[model samples]
Target: MGKLIENKWFLLLIIALTWGSSFILIKKSLLVFTPYEIGAIRVGVSGLLMAYIGIPALRKMSKKVLFWVILAGFFGNFFPMFLFPLAQTQVSSSLAGILDSLVPVFVLTFGFLFFGIRSRWIQFIGAIIGFIGAGSLMYFSEANREESQLFYAFLVVLATACYAVNALIIKEKLQDIPSLQLSSAVFSVWMVPSFIILVLSGFFQNFEASTPTYEALGYLGILTIMGTAVAMILYYKLIQNTSPVFASTVTYLLPLVAVIWGLLDGERFTIWYMVGGILILIGIYLIGKNKKPKLLS
Candidate 1:
């Protein structure tokens, strides 16, 4: 069991499962809270929880390391935390999951462009295919006819870009830090800011005592503890143990889990959406093929 826990593949699977289900939690939480409230509470709560480990780690960081940590936290956690919930306001959870697969392609693109990393032609081709699929996904989306929904879908893509930047920062700059310490410290940076947002969003003033409110809060708790906090620890560990592109491959499994949850929730699932998702997955496969193989051990 302990050995399995340490295995990168196992950690990948666990993070996929946890994060995939997060969409539904967000959807459910949205039943009672605004996107701002959900995002603020999720980040603020997760940050507080992480502070237990992070405060100690904070004491040990030099200024340079702290800057990278805070940057990673912003791109990786803070913005995406809000963007996703906002996107899901108009987009389906499954579609949000599908769009997230763009992370690896963007990772490759940004890595090659800014980080002095070299890439093969095949990877470039994969990036093109991935963008085509993403464009098709958005174009064919039921939401495309509506300007607001289309804008929201783009937000999800933008969030994926943020995630890509975060991954590169972790791989290039913060690789030497312990994964848990790094994750805790990153999340800790947003703790106070998130709480400030929560308060400013009128979360306290609009408080209600109702069954739905309690249920939404419960979902938020799970989303924070499992989806944000625990999954982040494992995700950082995976990134530290493997390449960022490889770690982002968890998105391949993430959509499947999210689609299942969406279906169970009775959300619409169209054939075109599936076609778009398949294209994205194929693009990811080609991208993965371009990677020099890593031993699964």
Candidate 2:
């Protein structure tokens, strides 16, 4: 247990398993639930679960910090939660996961644009390259031949941009807070609203009427537990123990799991996907390799 706790590789594996599997879980949940319902349930259940265990950490946070937490919640957690499922309705989970791997690239791009942070030239070039790769993946895919479906794939890209913004906010504005505290507080602030949305969506009625709903809900439970709550805890620990770049390498592994799961689920795959995904991953690597600027004051 002690070695597992301290080993960076072990921590990385855990994150990859928890977060990487989340895309397919979203796919499974969407079998019965609407994107809005899935998003609300995710945030609501994870928020409650974290709050139950994270009370001590939450108490230590200042009220003044709640604003940033809420911002992160809405952008980083809430919006992406909704967007991924929505995108998956039209896009493959494999593609969604591949697009999600663009978060670090967007992080670099947004950081330099809005935060007045300086970045190396390679990072800028990488962002452009990453965009191109994403475009190719969306536009050229036989799996998403419909022009409208391709447009929906862009929604996943936009979600990554939101994730980038949230990452910057957390680093610059909420540096003093612990990871668990930040996650718990963000979820706590958003929890009630999300739950209210879920309830208003008439989820319970559908849930009772369908056996598949039970199986879908079971997948969602794992998604909430392993993907959101527990993964946040592990991610925070990784950040503490390693450089940000090292911790972010989980991005590289995520699509592999998503792609493998997609294949097993009988989703189509082609050499074109491999080409575009490689380019995006390369761009992400370059972005991470660039020296990071100081967190915003």
Candidate 3:
């Protein structure tokens, strides 16, 4: 038991479950609170939860990297925190999960555009194929070309793009900092703003109004603490202990988890979703694979 508990693979599985469960929690949270409130509470609570560990790093952090930390906090945590809830309002949790897989593609795109990172021909082709799957998802959903839902789907895509940029910032600028410290500091920086917005938005008043609100908030708390804080700590450790390719497999696992949960919860599932999801997964596989394929044990 102890050996499995300490295993990196075990830890990765836990992180995958926690993160993949987050969308359903978000859906539950939205039942009682506005998307803004949900986003605010999610970030604010996650920030505060990590602050204890972050304080040590906070004191020792160099000013040289503070700007990057702040930028990461905004693009990585702040924007996506709100964007997911807002986007989920219009898009199904399953579809959102499918689209979220596009992060690596956007990561490569933004990396190439802003950081001068070059990709092989296959990576470019993979990205194009992935976007076509995304298009199929949008065009074929039951909403059926409703501009508003499509707009929200675009928001989710934009949020993934935000995630891509955050990945670049972490790789380029904050690589030296320990992942825990960097994440803690980033969330800590944004904590104040999220709290301010949360308060101004009157979450407490709404929170006290009903039993169902408390139930939903409880789920949100789990999402904030387990999903954001603990999963991030484990993710950083996973990256440290394993190859990037191994750690990146979580990208493939998350959608499966999300889609399964969505199905159980009675969210719409369609044949197009299956087709689009397979294409996106294949595209991701091609993008991640090199000329020489590596075997796993």
Candidate 4:
């Protein structure tokens, strides 16, 4: 049992499952809480839970490191946290999950353009393919005619861009830090600010006690503890044990889990969705195909 827990494959599977389910959990939580409230609570609660580890890490962290950590936290965690819930309000959880597969594509694009990482022509083609898939998904969505819904889908795309930037930061700057310590410190940095936002969102004043409220709060709890905190820890551990590229392959499995959950929850799935999804996956495979795993410095 202990050995299984230490297995990298097991950890990867768990991360994929936890993160994939997070979209549905966000959907469930929105039944009672606003997107702002949900985002703030997720960060605040997860930050609080990690305080024990994060506080000490922060104390020992040099200001130089903290600067990058803070930047990473915002792009990686903060903005995406809010963008996703906002997008989910208009877009289905399944579609949001599908769009998230764009992270690798954006990472490749940003890496070449801004981070000075070189890419092959094939990778450029992959990026274009990825964009085409994303556009098609949005264009053929049930809400395609609705400008607001299309805008919301683009929000998810924007969140993926933020994630891509964060990924480059981690790879270029924070690779030397212990993964657990880095995650803890990042969460700790945003803890207070997030809670402040929670209060400003009127969560307390608007709070009520009812079965639906309790259920929504329960989903938020799971989203915080399992999806954000635990999944992040496991994801980082996977990076330490393997490579970022390998850890990121979790993206391949994540959409499948989300699609399953979305279907079970009665969300619509169309033929165009399948087509777009396949193109995105194929593009991702091409983007990652030429890259060999290099051990973190």
Best by lDDT: 1
Write the residue-wise lDDT of candidate 4 on 61-156 in tens digits. 788988998998998778789999999988889999989988888878887777767777887898899899999998898547554568899999
Ranking by lDDT: 1, 4, 2, 3
C-alpha lDDT values of all predictions? 0.89, 0.81, 0.79, 0.85
What's model 3's overall lDDT?
A: 0.79
Which residues of candidate 2, in runs, are more than 4 Å off? 53-60, 240-246, 292-297
Better of 1 and 4 by lDDT: 1
Better of 1 and 2 by lDDT: 1
lDDT, candidate 2, 11-92, per-residue tens:
9888888888999999999988999998998889888977764566656667767777788778877888888898888888
User: Mind giving the per-residue lDDT tens digits that candidate 3 earns over 24-88?
Assistant: 99999888888888888877888898888776777787787888888877887888989999988
lDDT of 3 at 152: 83
User: Each model's TM-score, in the order given?
Assistant: 0.96, 0.91, 0.90, 0.94
- lDDT winner between candidates 2 and 4: 4
Report clash pairs, candidate 1: none
- Residue 86 lDDT, candidate 3, scale 0-100: 93
Greater-lDDT candidate between 2 and 3 = 2
Better of 1 and 4 by TM-score: 1
